[model samples]
Target: MTLNRSIGILALICLPAAGIWFWQNPTVRQAPQLSFKTIKGERIDLADLKGKLVLVTFWATDCPGCIEEIPHLVELHRQYSNAGLTIIAVAMYYDPPNRVMAMAKAKQLPYAVALDPSGSLAQGFGNVQLTPTTFLIDRTGRIVLQNTGAFELQDIRQRLNQL
Candidate 1:
């Protein structure tokens, strides 16, 4: 092989290896520092939950998809909360606090229901603009998964198991 051709081949191999190393590095994708104010006047700091797997879900009361996922989320919480999974359902800034509270009550949500009235929570989570944006963060505070809309519950369960 020509010198340039050999160098090109080496570059192709090394670049992908470097990319994979960077992507897989746990320190590269840490979740942002954020604190949530739950509906019942409770403060939850993400940093405090470092040793626990956390599922932070951005939702709106008026969102059909968000509403649809509640039952599955509730079940997930039921099955996993005792296994060190903390689920936080965040109501978007545009969602009225009263409506969020009413839905939380009506649905009998078992997990923490937070209010994002100023949209800061969404902003901290990569400026999330859509309802039902969910993030699965590992015990070490690395964000393992980010889903924009509806997600597969089984897949989430598998991930939770692995984490």
Candidate 2:
């Protein structure tokens, strides 16, 4: 193979490998402070959820993968909330606010939902440029996992089991 072609193949292979490593063994990161009003006009903040495991997801209404993840998120919240788990779904700025709100309502999502007008919230989470990115934060308010794309639900549950 040509040198450039070889390098391209290697990059394609290694980049995702690195992302998986980052996702599974995320270094402890102090979660970016978050405070926002939900679509239901309820205010929420990470600080307020101290001592609770939290999952913050960045998504858009038009993203099928994001839509696919909602039921899993709802299940997680319902099963774990009393045990101190919290979830916040932040809708990406490009999606119309009305549609975002509609999706949350139609799904009857059990977690907090916030709309980003200009993607600032996603930027704080490492400039999330895609739909369905998720971060799992520990009870101590540090991010323990970061997954982009269609995150495996079983993997997430396994990680939570560890914590």
Candidate 3:
């Protein structure tokens, strides 16, 4: 009777923990729905890039880490762009569109960029608290990789090679 009771208690305890684990895991969550305006004032749907690897990077113009990461991202885009990779830089901070555009132009970024004025997309993607947070989505729209800090060029290349 004691063994049965202990097993029952264990089952009760483990069930909720497993439920929480599954809830918080990105693999279990639905692919975030993203729709925002590009720097050119055109609307873009995240789903539109199906069948290609998508690199969605959340950044702010004033963030030091973000500033440092842009050049690496640009280089990554340049290197892998012909290999079916699409890099999208999403400016999440509340900055003027012209300011963001000017910065992009100054940096000579070759990838596409969009402004998240409402910040809804960031919130939907799990509140993305840090600047330079990057998400690597596979061809099927699954978030295969998520990095919360700056990434090295070789690291990105290695990850892309797996996809």
Candidate 4:
């Protein structure tokens, strides 16, 4: 095939792939009721967390960005739990329970870390491509803000204050 034809075919292949990826990954419109087992092995239902400011962050154990943001999340939970905030870290990819426990212990995370071994919860929340996606749900259970990447402490604080 000619160089121009080869380039055209490559573009054709890449364009559809990009489109599919973009279509499959969009900001979550409605929050789904996710039921998962916490690292402590207790079943928790997302609907049970209503009437509180909840941060549902989807992350994976191997994600560097997710690892880096744990401390910030811990701080947010610490500063605001007394104010009726609930932060739940939903692990999108499966890892050994020990690893999850160790990371939580090392960071001294005060919030609950749940396991989404099948990643269905992550997909339901429109966080297909990224780890560390955070959704802020108000007391009434409406998603007020959805962040696809790592967030700053100030941003989290401001969002919490608004709730």
Candidate 5:
């Protein structure tokens, strides 16, 4: 093959890999605003949380993955909260409001926990349909990471540390 043809072939191969990387881990340029009355009755607003690293986590009470991820999230909250991280844990629509309330209380979740009873919260977040889907919004209010399924805590921590 000519040198030019080899370069073209390499470009073609790399293009698809780049596209897949962008597709699977897309950045949410401007995260839709979210305001919710947390299970604890305090109102939290995404817009109001500017200048802080925000983790908008969507989880359901019944999801085993969600259950397993809480402790790690709590530790993240503990490690980073005072340093500028804020996590808003939202219970997914399928989980009953009462159950969400019960679980939040039972867990004694250190961070704010909100119930998506009307499904509005999840809908605002691109119609979030999966449990343990998390978005990491940068300090300037732009969402930089969208994670679906159980959080890869080590990966997440690395990203968090970079911010």
Candidate 6:
């Protein structure tokens, strides 16, 4: 094949790969304007947390994955809370407050735990319907990461460190 033709073919292959990488990875986006009232009666507004790195996780008490992730979240909170990291675990509207509170107590979660009784929190976050959906917002209020399933703790830690 001619050298020009070979170069053209390589460019075509690489362009799609780059596009896919961009599509699969996190992109800069503004976080939704919302306020959360924690089960502890602490009102946390996103605007108030503008200069902090926040992790807003949507979870349900009954979800096995969510249940399994509590410890990790707790540890993350312990490790980074003092370093400007704020973690909020939000219980789905379907989950009764009693159950949510019980799980929080049982898990000994140290972060703010909010109850989405009206589902407005979920709706504001792109109509999230999956348990363990997490949004990592930077200090500037831009969502740097959005994971809909189980997320790697190390990856989160690295991102947190980078921020």
| Top lDDT hit | 6
Return whichever of 1 and 5 wins on TM-score.
Answer: 5
Model 6 TM-score? 0.88
lDDT of 3: 0.83
Q: Clashes in model 6: which pairs? A: none
10 residues in a row with least lDDT, candidate 3: 22-31
Off by over 4 Å in 2: 1-23
lDDT (tens digit, per residue) of candidate 4 on 72-151: 98888889999989888987766666788888778777898987767687877764658778888888777777777887
Instruction: Count clashing residue pairs in model 2.
Output: 0
Candidate 2's residue-wise lDDT over 1-163, tens digit each? 6999999999999999999887757656988887877899988888887788999999999899998999899888888888888889999889899998888889999899998897889888889989899999998889888888978989888888888
Clashing pairs in 1: none
In model 5, residue pairs whose N, Cα or C atoms come closer than 3 Å (at least 3 residues apart or on different chains), thus clashing, are none
Name the better of 2 and 6 by TM-score.
6
TM-scores for every candidate against the unseen true structure = 0.84, 0.83, 0.79, 0.76, 0.85, 0.88
lDDT of 1 by residue, 1-163 (tens): 6999999999999999999876754343799999999999999999999999999999998888998899889999999999999999999999999999999999999999999888899999899999899999999999988888987899899889888
Worst 10 residues of 5 by lDDT: 24-33
Q: Which of candidates 2 and 3 is the stronger one according to lDDT?
A: 2
Candidate 4, residue 91: CA error in Å? Answer: 1.2
Superposition error at 73 for model 5 (Å): 0.6
Error of 6 at 35 (Å): 0.3
Global Cα lDDT for candidate 6: 0.92
Per-candidate total of colliding backbone pairs: 0, 0, 0, 0, 0, 0
Ranking by TM-score: 6, 5, 1, 2, 3, 4
What is candidate 2's CA lDDT for residue 74?
88
Stronger candidate by lDDT (3 vs 4): 3
